[model samples]
Target: MDTTSNLEEAVEVLQQLGLKEYEARCFVGLSRLHSGTAKQLSEMTEVPRTRVYDAIRMLEAQGLVEIQHSSPQQFRAVPLEEATETLRDQYDARVERLHDALETVEIVDTDDESSVQQVWAMTGQDAIENRTNDLIREATDEIVLVVGDESLLTEDLIDTLNEVGNGVDLLIGALTETIQDRIRVAVPEATTFISGLEWLHGENATVDETAIGRLLLVDRSTILVSSIMPTTREERAVFGEGFGNGLVVIARRLMAQGLLTVRDPKQ
Candidate 1:
């Protein structure tokens, strides 16, 4: 109801993230204090004598408050701009370490299988495309693509893929008329299909000539199969290497035996 009540709630949320009650209180109280001590802070912020020392200690540790330790510690808030800049540096370092640890865990050793291949799961649209392009650029022989349509692929991305040239055999599934025309404009050399692939019709795409969803085969070693939300517009694609179970194994076998026919788009 009270407009200031919303800001009070936000301050509580920040306090929960590790800000001390006295630190939070002192920081908020400081704007009112202009500068104050344990007693003044206690009076203004409604903090108690028994808990003030503990609160001051927490605030001091956070660098949000400075302590002028005399008979009693006089506390004052660090300037807001300085406090924020200090916190940003601390948080950035913690985040960098976390990212390094996650990247290290991408490959794990399993007792059941030899370490010949690795599979990774990439989330987000940009991440999926980056991993897909990595596979294509790394490919020595071919790149088999089963993508949704041209609307999904931007003009710039298409240009980069086209640089792969004849070394990449692009097998594309156009989910709609829009995709087919876009594909033609993007990669005139790619093999195109209009039938058995699911989810194409809603986008006005022709069905695949074979049963396929989103399958991208990279030089017969890496594969990505996407799962689309049947109801929503969002889609997720999973990337796997040759040594995994289920679809990875089956697709790898198909690519090995040359069963998934590689016909030229010209045909």
Candidate 2:
């Protein structure tokens, strides 16, 4: 590891790609030279001269190195572009094999899948956004979403909202009129409103208290409510799917705050 930062970094990356420590060092050492002998690779990489030959043989088997059988022996790494492509293909193949191997495992859950109402918790902004978009896509009758923060109006969410089928009713509410206006232009087909939920961003709120993030009610059945935690400002969400479930019912009421009467999900 007592080498140039760039060389050390290259060796670390190669090891992460499934190369052994000595193999990575040898491959990286050879990469810097058009051709190198065992002694030269050992001196450059700090790997034992005796181990260099073994590492070179493994690298050659993996199509990362080419060996010239001279009296002492010579080794050269494959061209950088070709070597990268080979590694990528190898990594992809390994991933595919792992997926295939695990795909056949049977679920061991003893409880019936639908016997009880289930609520799952999720964290992270990207994950919450993806789950919200998925719920929107699955809506057959209605998709009601309330944005508590303007920052959550990402292009991906807008794209997902715009892609909703014409047959589905799409209602989007923003905490402020300006955000509502943006939503209106971004998705003209949807009805946009300025939310009446004052608690989402009350005047007394401070950095120590959690803030409302986003609320999504799809088909009046599936519900996702996320909150931004204090201090770190990390997003977390709880998702539940079931018509007439308590969580779903509460979300429906909350999202339909400004309306005179809440529409029945079944209707």
Residue 64 CA displacement from its true place in model 2, Å? 8.5
Task: Rate residue 73 of model 2 by lDDT.
Answer: 89
Tens-place lDDT per residue, model 2, 74-171, is 89999999999999999999999999989988878976567237889999999999999888998899888889877788999999999999999888
* C-alpha TM-score for every candidate: 0.47, 0.66
lDDT of 1 by residue, 1-267 (tens): 574675476468557655756567667776555567778878877889667778777767778778777766676778878877876776787789889989888676577965346555555656666766777778776676665433357665577678786766666656566676778777878766653444433444333322223567776567887554544434567677654445566665443322244452111
Model 1: CA > 4 A from native: 1-112, 115-120, 199-213, 230-232, 243-245, 249-267
Strongest candidate by TM-score: 2
The weakest ten consecutive residues by lDDT in model 1 span 258-267
